[model samples]
Target: MSAEIMPYVVAGAMAGGFINGLAGFGTALFALGFFLVVLPPFQAVAMLVVLSVITGLQGLWIVRAAIRQNTRRLARFLLPGLAGIPIGVMILSVIDASTLKIVVASMLLLYGGYFTLRARLPRFERATPFWDMLVGFLGGILGGAASLSGALPMMWCTLRPWPKQETRAVLQPFNVAVLAVTTILLALKGAYTRETLIYLAIAIPAALLAAQIGITVFKRLSDTAFRRLLILMTFVSGLVLMLRAVL
Candidate 1:
């Protein structure tokens, strides 16, 4: 990349890493904005996923206890999630960046609006294996296409009766695992380029540093406040996505 672009990417990586480390998911959203301006949207998402794996690995380690406790639930969603990854990639290969921007932007807006209005919303009545599989499948597809799949199944977990920690733990590993597969597929499909690797090297550390800061913040935060923050960020991210699409 050019010198001027390099700085923007590094700044984006730092912002993405810090937000994700603090919030557990905003990395891709932030990266999306930065990369879309610097690269194609699909390429931006693919590169972001690679950087996310590096950052997410740190998150997984910090939440190891939570992961262990929710292994079974995560495992339940793995197969379907894995199965759907290629579908997302296939879609990405065919669709132009403009279409992806519009579709993802619209989805984020609708999802954010709904969640913001009803932070305490319930899950689908039939959140059984069938629904889980279907959701996982769709999430994987979207993930492959846009790297925004992290929010979908997580929304399902949020409405469950479990304690917040348990819910978060259950989703973390699954999100990481799904992203891992999606990243690999994207790389194989030619999303991984020399510039992408260079960006990853710089961005991954930013993610780790930000994650540590987040851990500190998380330790200080109350659960109710954290929930409110999550809702607020989701809404903000939706607006950002919409703007990216339209502008």
Candidate 2:
């Protein structure tokens, strides 16, 4: 990457990390929205995969106890997610760059719009195992393709009657596992070039610092406030992604 581009990369990483810390997801949506502006789709996805693992670890640590208590629910989402990653990766390998960008950007726009009007949206009467698996599978595919595995699950979790912490417990660990798999697959596929490593080195510290700030803020927020902030961020992320795709 060029010297001029380093600032954008760092900014994206920090923004993504902060959002992930605050909301327990949206790392890819926010990070990739900025990254695709300065890098190719593959490289941008690769970078976010690595950084997402770091942020995921942070989130998991914050919600470790809750995760242990809800192991069964987590598994319902995770087991299917594991099955879906390779399929998404395979699609990523074959798809053209422009098409990939459009698909990812469109997903962001659609999901973002959904979240923005989520309060007015009807709620699910009950959670089903089938819906959990489907959401996880779709999330895994998106994760493998563009490091966006959390969006679907996050949206699904919101519809349920769970509190904010419980929602984080389910989504954060699932995101960690999916992102870990995606990172490993990318490494095996030789997606991480020397430039990617260089970018990672520069971006990690900024991401960590920003995430800490977000985590601090997150603790003070009520469930209702958190949901509102999440929807607003989702909408903003979608707008940014759409702009990147069009321009």
Candidate 3:
């Protein structure tokens, strides 16, 4: 990466790490918007996958206790997500990158809009394994395609009758597993180059530092406040994704 481009990349990493730290998701949405400005789509997605793993690890540590207690429940969501990943990886190899970005952006916009109007919308009942697996499958496809596996699960958790901590417990680990798979697939595809390593050297530290700051902010917010913030950020992320595609 050029010296001039490094700053934007670091800024994006920090912003992404912060959001992921706070809400346990959205690292790609927040980071890729800035990265897409300076990097090609493949390179940017590769970098975000690496950073997503870093952020996911950090987030897991923050919520370790909840994860331990709910491991069984989480497995219901993760197993099918694992099954769906290879299909998503195949899509990534074959699909037009620009078209994928537009599709992802449109999904984000619709997801955000739905949540913004959630109060007016009818409430969903408790989550069933069928729905969990369905969303997890979709999330895996998106994750493999664009490092966006978390969005659907995040939105799903909000609609379900879960508390904030439980929501984090499930999605954080799920993201870690999916992104870990993404990284391996990218490596198999030889997406990582010398430049990618250099970018990671810069990104990892920025991401870790910002994640801590976000965790601090998350600790301070009430459950109600956190949910509202999550909704707003989702909407903002969608707008950013769409703008990146157009401009």
Q: How does each model score on TM-score? A: 0.80, 0.82, 0.86
lDDT of 3 by residue, 2-76 (tens): 888999899999988998889887788778778988989899888887888888788889778888888877887
Report, for every candidate in turn, its global Cα lDDT versus the true structure. Answer: 0.69, 0.79, 0.81
Model 1, span 103-142: residue lDDT tens: 7666656766787787475544344777766767777787
The C-alpha stretches of model 1 lying farther than 4 A from their native spots are 39-43, 90-108, 114-129
lDDT of 1 at 207: 63
lDDT of 2: 0.79
In candidate 1, the residue pairs with backbone N, CA or C atoms under 3 Å apart (3 or more residues apart, or in different chains) clash, namely none
Candidate RMSDs in Å, in order, are 3.3, 3.1, 2.6
Ranking by lDDT: 3, 2, 1
TM-score of 1: 0.80
- Taking all chains together, the TM-score of candidate 2 against the true structure is 0.82
Better by lDDT, candidate 3 or 1: 3
Error of 2 at 55 (Å): 1.5
